[model samples]
Target: MTATDDKTVVREYFNATGFDRWQRIYGDGEVNKVQLDIRKGHQQTVDTLMGWLEADGNLAGLSCCDAGCGVGSLTIPLAQAGAQVYASDISAKMVEEARQRAEVALEGKNLPTFEVKDLEELAGRYHTVICLDVLIHYPQDKVQGMISHLGSLAESRLIMSFAPKTLFYSALKKVGEFFPGPSKTTRAYLHREADIVKALEAEGWRIERRTLTKTQFYFSRMLEAVKDQ
Candidate 1:
């Protein structure tokens, strides 16, 4: 698909289902298997991110940019932890919902900067740049550019996650598409780990840590890379 098509598909898909994901996260609704699987996967990602952020030290005084921060999963929590956060997503509705959620979730804190923006539109450097579960939207050919762009926005650490490319994982995602109802699926890309590493390395970032988070029906390869001084 062309870039425009990819954007349209992703925006539409998230616009429709992003709230469902949010509600499921808060135990607000009954979720189907696909939604439940995604929720489970994201929970792992958020927990992992929090641990990494704690290890990075001094959360109350750090700068963070959470690109593709769907419904404030990571954004609100980061802001609550006392970091100044700039958060963005491709879906306008998602951004709005995130703002609303943050207003309620972070009542006493300075709200995170939330905007509807594509990956390329995000600007500025931060102590840490975290983009989780969003790389699955980009195909292989575009992954490096995304990685490089995100890496450039990080002064210290960059954390990202992608649906991993493996014989079983690739086939699993494909089979998932077939099993989900027509309205329940969107374009999903599985990326090679080697290529992601190469992209970060070229940008003068080295992987500090990596892990594979596997839930019942979801798989994500999460990496934390630090810009080499």
Candidate 2:
């Protein structure tokens, strides 16, 4: 698809009425279990990243950028940990909710800088750059370029997640496609581990750790890598 087509699809999905429904689902406390599971999954990935950061003693005063930061899930925690954070999302509503959530979670602490912008508009280098559940919206042909761009925004580390590629996983994804619900982006692209590695390697990033999680709705693979400096 052309760039315009890509943007249109993204805009439609994020701006659609379905997203409003999703925001309510995500923001409601009635579904605490679902939220907890989601948090647990993200925390697992964050723990792995923290371990990597600790390996190098000179990593303090680090700045982190959370591209596609939704509802401040990882963003607020990172900010609470005293890291300078810059978070951005393509959806205006998502950014607004994230800002509100951050205000409450970071009431007595410094807040991360939040904005509504696409990954391509991101500027400045951070010690760590995270793009989670964001790349799935991009077409297969554009993933490598997107990865390279994210890598450039990081001075030391980059962590990203993608839907895994497997027969079982693909079948499950197809089922999800059938039961369409409100999400910022509707189109999902599953990536093979080998292909994901190749894309990062092409941008001179070396994978340091990988983790896979299988949930009822999705199978996610997260990777932590270091940019070749």
Candidate 3:
């Protein structure tokens, strides 16, 4: 599919029940293997980001933008971590859900501003910008551009996660695509770590840390990159 077609599929997939179901998995505290594995991987990535953010300096006054802030998972925590957060998502439904969750999580105080925006459309720079798990929806060619855009938005740091490319993992994903299940998703793209780093470097960023999480059903490479002044 073309980039536009992939974007449409991603928009529709997250707008439907599939999105809600994933939210439930993220919220339900992992009742099944898929949920359990995904939760394990997702939490690890979030923790890695948070750790890097804190290590960078005080979080209380820094501005953070969470691109593809799914259901307020990272957005809520980032706000709670004492950062001013601006959260956006390509899916309208996701932005709405994230706004609602942030309201509830913050006890009716909306600390993190929420909006429906895509990576390509996100504007403004912050001390740090994070785009997690969202890269799986982008093809290889597009991933680099998105990474560059994200890099440009961060004055100091950019944290992101992607399904890492490896022959074995790619083969597994391809084989699994043949059989559809309840949580079946739109086409996912796996990217090489080197390619992502090169994209970041092109935008004047350097990786400070890297973390990988792998489970029976989940996998991701989390990188914390700091921009060069």
**lDDT per residue (tens digit) for residues 1-229 in model 2:** 6765776677566656645654555554554444445545555665666665556654445798999887777787677777888999887878888899999988957789998898888889888999987777777788888898988888888899887778877786677642244443456778888988999988888998888865445457889998655
Residue 197, model 3: Cα distance from true site in angstroms: 1.0
Model 1 bad stretches (over 4 Å): 17-27, 177-181
Winning model by TM-score: 3
Candidate 3, residue 7: Cα displacement in angstroms equals 0.7
lDDT per residue (tens digit) for residues 59-140 in model 3: 9878999999988888998888789999998889888888888888888654798888778999998988988998888988
Which has the better lDDT: candidate 1, or candidate 2?
1
Q: List the residue pairs that clash in candidate 1.
A: none
Question: Over the full model, what C-alpha lDDT does candidate 2 score relative to the true structure?
Answer: 0.75
Question: By TM-score, is 1 or 3 better?
Answer: 3
lDDT (Cα, 0-100) at 223 in candidate 2: 92
Per-residue CA lDDT of candidate 1, range 77-106, in tens? 898888999999998878888899899998
Q: C-alpha displacement of 215 in model 3, angstroms? A: 1.4
List the candidate 2 regions with Cα displacement exceeding 4 Å.
1-3, 16-18, 32-60, 177-185
Q: Pull out the clashing pairs in model 2.
A: none
Off by over 4 Å in 3: 177-180
